[model samples]
Target: MKRDKISVVGFMGSGKTTIGLLLANFLNYFFYDLDEYIEKKEGKSIKDIFADYGEEHFRNLESFYLKELIEKHNKIVISTGGGIIKREINRKLLKEKTFVVFLDGSFEVFMNRLEGTEEKDKRPLMSLGKDELYNLWISRKPLYEEVATLKINVDSKTPYQIVREILDFYGKM
Candidate 1:
């Protein structure tokens, strides 16, 4: 099916935001990072939201924001939060409204990219150690795959290369 918009989804550190920006520029579409949108709407940092309201509350807000965004935007590329696919409704909305791409990356690569980052406190999920992170990856991988129209492995690729891959996959190149 043809789509007017694109939505990029992936685990944390998978370059969804970075590659989404480049892809949106190439496609000349507006770019929306859902997490950043939520942060703006809530008037608080994601870290603060997680600390104050907890993950469930934050997720509820995320769902609300995503629905509003999809309802109101077109010809845009949206980068969704890693856990966005956890909800079936979000998955259906994304599938109906946009071309969904899963940017897949290995856990080691993700850890390497995320290492020493100050954003850890803001991302409660990343507070886990290596083993727990791996477990999280294992559990979430299937959900990411299940909802994606296209899956691009980003293990060793640059953001630009990933954008190229996405364009190729979407037959837009």
Candidate 2:
């Protein structure tokens, strides 16, 4: 299949946003971060949305935004939120519109990257501590794998390296 767009999904702190931007730039395509899109549309940060309306409401908005974005863009790179794979509808839309790349990473690396950050405020799932976080990752891993067309281990890679790997793997480099 000829890929016109690419969707990057992974756990929080897996560098989806960073690598998505790099990949978009590398391919000369537009870049969209789903969380940022939601924030812009709602006139509120994701942290505030989660605080006031809760995760379910936030996810609804995210789905809406993602659908709109997919319809509007042709050549683009999207960095989806960590929990995007939870919804089967989201997975279906992604599969139809783009090649989904799962950024696979270790729980220890994720913990190290997320350390000292206020991610819990913006990402509700990260509120759980190390053990709980690891468990959550374990549970979500299968869902990510199920929808992924490509999987890349990002535990010890730089953003540029990951982008290079994605391009190479996709035969776009």
Candidate 3:
């Protein structure tokens, strides 16, 4: 594969940021956590953005920044926000422009990963509680699978293991 961008996509708390940093470092590429980039660009937290402007507005901002990154960078590893796939434009970009790695983990896994963590608090969706978050995960799983160039079950792997898995597979490609 002609490696340009590798995007790690999954629900919140699936280790996208952790593994993305490792992947970028291993490959000597720039790393951009989409959420962090958006936060920095907006001069506020995502939690605050969702609180102040609501989901629709947040989604628009998400789509805009996503396009900017896709267009502006090639040698990059982007850890996209969970809700990014909600937009068809974003999905098309991922499917066409980048090698997407779907971190496939069950709802239980996701819940366990985020429970009582700072990630759980920062995510506006998680504040809706388990049922809502689970539903969101369920809905997005197929979308992630649809765009994924590779899917790795993340139930029991350490960040290092997952990063190695990605690197090994990407190298072969």
Question: Could you give the C-alpha RMSD of every candidate to the true structure, in order shown?
Answer: 1.5, 1.6, 1.1
Better of 2 and 3 by TM-score: 3
Name the runs in model 2 displaced over 4 angstroms. Answer: 118-121
lDDT of 2 by residue, 35-144 (tens): 99989989999988998999899889989999999998889999999999889999888877888999998988877887787764567667677788888899889989
- Candidate that scores best on lDDT: 3
Q: Tell me, by TM-score, which candidate is best.
A: 3
* lDDT string, candidate 1, 1-173, tens digits: 64768899988988888989999999899999998999999999887898899988988998899989888988889999988988888888888778899999888888788778775556778877879878888888998888788999999888888888888878852
Global lDDT of each model? 0.86, 0.88, 0.90
Q: Mark the 10 consecutive residues where model 2 has the least summed lDDT.
A: 118-127
Model 3 Cα lDDT, one tens digit per residue, 1-173: 54888899998878889889989998999999999999999999999999999989999999999889989998999999988899898999899989999988888887888878888889888768678777888889999999999999988999889998998999888
- After superposing candidate 3, which stretches have Cα over 4 Å from the reference? none
Tally clashes: model 3. 1
> What's model 2's overall lDDT?
0.88
lDDT of 3: 0.90
